[model samples]
Target chain A: MLIWNRAKILYIKKINWHLCLIFAAISSQPILTSMTWKQVFSSSIGRKLTMGLTGIFLITFLIVHMGINACMWAAVYFKDDHGEMFNKAANFMGSMVVIRIIEFGLFFFIFLHIIQGYMLTVYNRSKRAVGYAVDYGSKGSKWYSRSMGLLGTLILLFLIIHWLHFWIPSRFTGVEEVEYNGVKMHNMFALMQTTFQQLWVVILYVLGCISLGYHLAHGFQSAFKTIGVHNKRYQTMLTGLGYAFAIVVPFVFAMMPITMYLGWVK
Target chain B: MEHYNMSLHLKVWRQNNSRDKGHFENYKVDGISSEMSFLEMFDVLNERLITEGKEPIAFDHDCREGICGMCSMYINGKPHGPWKSNTVCQLHMRAYKDGDTIVVEPWRANAFPVIKDLMVDRSAFDRIVQAGGYISVNTGNAVDGNSLPIEKDKADASFAAAMCIGCGACVAACKNSSAMLFLSAKVAHLALLPQGEPERKKRVVSMVAQMDKEGFGACTNTGACEATCPKDISLSNIARLNQEYLIASLTADK
Candidate 1:
């Protein structure tokens, strides 16, 4: 009887060990699958999904950016403060830990977007091994839709210049700081005013905004369409909103440099 | 009725098989009637080639009235020629000028390998369809047509999607050679109907997996597919497919 009981306990232990092994393997399946770079990035659909998600995130970032920059116009309405509101808003954004973390995410997403955009463009070109004998330009689709790669590249160049002018100095190097109520903050408003003073700089900013407008014109609704928002009524509404947002946000961004350069805001 | 005759220069792609190197072999066909369809003109060219004891250009065509969706020819730079909502079979020669040089070629995509000169193996489409294109139901006495009362708008939308003839025009027209439009059409056709409810989740997931497996490119929503679609299939169908796939991915057991 004692021998049988010991044998039964040993058998139970073996079965439990096997069950644990199976369960562990099953639970680790997702992690293993995610570790595969090819499964995530190599497929065409995977690349597209990445593009759409990143594009939408960038669009959201643009809205927040435009909102902060529009604070310059607050001085125009409230003349007593002299762009104080804009400075405070800028300082709060720079100091916040959460926003700072998100800022890192934003850079990561932008880099991914750029890399994926170039990859898709190359893949698309390779799909057509030979060029068409006759050019069917603009007849098949909108010129802007086909020229996303070009527009995206232009925007990327603009971003580098803009970052050099503002972001790099504000973050890493010392910049003109203003102490407002004992809180020392980088005077981004002053930086913008000084930067826009140059005619070439102002022109480049405007051109960059124009490229952004065209990019958003196609990208806004396209992201929605990509993720499967296809109701006719909703589509019409999204398209209308897209057009308005594309034109309005970029226009506001472009106007800031112009107004600053012209000394209208001051 | 009056008919006008014109002489035309043709640069058609000729590949003996999938392995053979293909090249443009130019042939001149004179006194061609403007009333003849594009395929009819090809038939005239093929007849002449046969009489000369030369290897005739092989192309796919059946149901010359355009419903079969078998005829695919890349004319000039556009798929199915330069007309809107027109297939190669339905495209009349009158659209061309007397001294025009028409460049004809096969649908070029990695997924669509050339079987001959103008015939591409579109069996990728068949495999995609086989992946889960049908609803699951046991065969029995026919169910009453009126048993399921579908909404009018939904039915209309489904019918529009069902109009897809499985022609690979959308694939050929896409810059990326994506088949989202085609796959979406198939998904929407069944998803709109009540009979398709049981297998709806499985259908979308499996079909999309199959589509990706076939080595087709991703859809960028450039609208070229909608623009060049002979059936005038909307890009909205693609949106529906996306919606379906997302829902399935989240809710389906698999």
Candidate 2:
């Protein structure tokens, strides 16, 4: 009887151990941990953050690009040596290792922005399984704001064309080198002039610039708002600046192709 | 006030239950006074339907003066009809023409499933609010409100945010069906005052987590929420919510 009692007590102890082990495993299953990096980035807000950050970076790149291209007009100021300033700037940008590294980063951001933009568009569409019977186009928000997906798609196509015209040739092959202030650089100015000479290409370029302007008109203030600039005064200022940027930047970009095509720089 | 009598054709959604597929059923409402509110016109329609021995349409409503935020309707492709910053309860019949065809639907979002014709199970919103939408102080006699000495601008801003009645019109108007405007209004209202500082970090994080978990779509800053808001809630509240979330996430001890 004593032996049987001892054996029964041992069996109960063994069952208790198993129960403890199961409880421990269940409690430690990562459900109790705070949000992970994957959770933060995969959330809807995270996707918007990615879009806004990449957009701001691309906006900055546009400013630098516009500055460099504006040097084409400087040919008029320094008529003795047409496009000297422009060539010099282009050569510096092309040769610098740091700039080249940043160019890669810019490419990465552009692709990221495009991919995330499409993902968001798809997600937004799926949220509305049924379309409204009565359409209120341009009544609730601006047409451009609601049409961001279409505008972005247009920008992507234009970007591919723009890269083929200049970026590919300059970076890879079939580019004549010019001496600018005792330094050799890809002759981007000559390339631009020749590229713009085609009427179809020039027209496409102008249309691309217009699309870009509308995209920026909405995206500029949007990026700021997304990043948490919520004060009324600051919001008003940002909106004003956004309008100016939307008009002036694209206007300048559109002019580059037109002036080159018309031989205004020469 | 001038009253104009009008006859209108109303096509309203009728759903028996959440699981049942819904469709629009047309009803003719005659001799509706221009002075009658939009919900009153619906009341007239319901009276006619009941008289004919048909089941009355079910919708959510309280405080018919527009403060309760229960009245939700998607009228003519716009939430709360074509009038800006107007709830259906406040929308007068005068806004419609003599022979207009008005289509009404419920707030459509995966997060807000339909419970009946025009009513949705918005307990998801209540869950989000329960997550961290309040201060954690012990309940007792109220503190002297004057002792806080909150800045006038801050007070006003908080008041503006507090004006949100939790009407899901922002969600209805958003193309993405995002609850950012509504969530931000709650977050901003608490985050602005000193009383909310104790749990500020935890509140924003938990509420946003709850929001995402509820399966709402992301905000794209389309401005439709602000445009359709009956209380004129600003889009800036969304920006403030984003800021709060970012700060909390970066500084969180976990």
Candidate 3:
């Protein structure tokens, strides 16, 4: 690690004089240097801050995921060709070295989120060793707001099913390849069509989408609030925007499987 | 409203100390007036217990008017009982019907350990407050309030945040037992004013650090704190604290 740091500093020297100084200044900051893993994970405020940052990253990934898949609709409606646009989009995303490198960061963030979430759930439960005897449910807060852990667990399960169904096939085990306009790519659209043929798969996907919606409903505005958007005016705007995104993004995603199962996107 | 007397069954938590695993002790009280406060009803039960050669149940209370925030009762699975924006002392017997069985417990956060019965040691809150809940001022004549030109809206918001009475109701109501609402209320109470401008950044950072050190849980945006707060402290203060912490963390010169 020391050697890597020296090498990186030397490399920065070759880049620009001002860039080297800025890098030096940034590297010397005490907050980054002083923070330990135990402190990061154990501190309640620090953990929540981590949740906010990671949650925002995942929220952005959803948009990208939905947008890339929406290529199928564009292919069908615009070009009167099935799976052409989607396959091309998938192949481009899959083949890029830069994208592949970023994929590691994506996975790291995803795992960090899930691990931190579980850790917090466990730790928070320990705060109240014994709960109230009388069951007063949802009077003080919204049920969904309090049920983030359950919703998150559901989303995690959905992600596992999703990885099994699509991510594994595309990344590890090769899917059937088809050439579209002289470029060979994994026929992910065809694979999706075949997968959606099963009623249970479609049902599971819809359930996953519903869980995602509720999770995002709380998580969207929550991320911003955690990062310090706490005023009444901006807060109201973000909340309204968050609820809309929660409904729309998940609806669009749920429609992906529905359209395929109904043969509307073949 | 028609006033009437009623008989009620009580399942009050009784513990000798923080270490002891407490149990609910049942007591039946007759001819309790609806006009009496909930604490008054407890007074009746304690009187009965002492006469019967039994120990009186211990609980904390002062300024039964709800301002001191000393009464920490988790009655019927809620902090400060069934009334909206109310403390247990302010809660009347009229809220319940005859023969109603009330389950009372203390603030069950790890930070606020049970002293005995329904009373818990809440010095954790004082420590958090000490961390950075005030503005450093010189010992001199009081500053003129009119000299400080402050916005009306911000002042109102600041005053609202200042209304937090150092109660653990927010923690009691929270599933995670988070002190975010309470801590944030403290942070915002000072942060919104010019007097707090000098230590604005340090106040939030240190307070949050103290809060985390105190073994409180993180806020999950459940809104339970706001709903059950007797002072009606808004959850928006928590959001403001988040923003303040983020800014402070990012820009800390040291």
Could you tell me the TM-score of candidate 3?
A: 0.90
Q: Could you say which candidate leads in TM-score?
A: 2
The local lDDT score (0 to 100) that residue A188 gets in candidate 3 is 94
How many clashing pairs in candidate 2? 0
Clashing pairs in 1: none
For all candidates, the clash counts are 0, 0, 1
User: In candidate 3 chain B, where is summed lDDT lowest over 10 consecutive residues?
Assistant: B130-139
User: Alpha-carbon error at A34 in model 3, in Å?
Assistant: 9.3
What interface RMSD, in Å and to 1 decimal, does model 2 have?
6.1
TM-score of each: 0.89, 0.91, 0.90
| Ranking, lDDT, top scorer first | 3, 2, 1
Question: Please, what are the lDDT tens digits per residue for candidate 2 over residues A68-146?
Answer: 8899899877867677788888888888899999989999999999999999888877776756666655667888888
Off by over 4 Å in 1: A1-46, A77-80
Error of 3 at A227 (Å): 0.5
Q: lDDT tens digits, residues A207-232, model 3?
A: 99999999999999988888878778
Q: Compared with the true structure, what per-residue lDDT tens digits does model 1 show for residues B1-254?
A: 56899999999999999898789999999989999999999999999999999999999999988788999998998899989998999999999879999999899888888999999998788667656676555556998978889999989999999999988999988877888899999999999998788768767766777777786778888899999999999999988887787666555443
Q: Residue-wise lDDT of candidate 3 within B1-254, one digit each (tens)?
A: 89999999889999999899999988889999999999999999899889999999998999999899899999988999999999999999999999998889888889899999999988788667655676655545877889989999889999999999877999999999899999999999888998888878767777777787788888998898999999999998988888787677666665
The residue-level lDDT of candidate 1 at A251 comes to 97
- Candidate 2 C-alpha lDDT tens digits along B1-254: 67789999999999999899899999888999999999999899889889999989898888988898999988988888878888899999999879899999989988889999999877677667656677756556889999889999999999999999999888888888889999999999999999889878877877788888887888989898899999999999999998987777677677
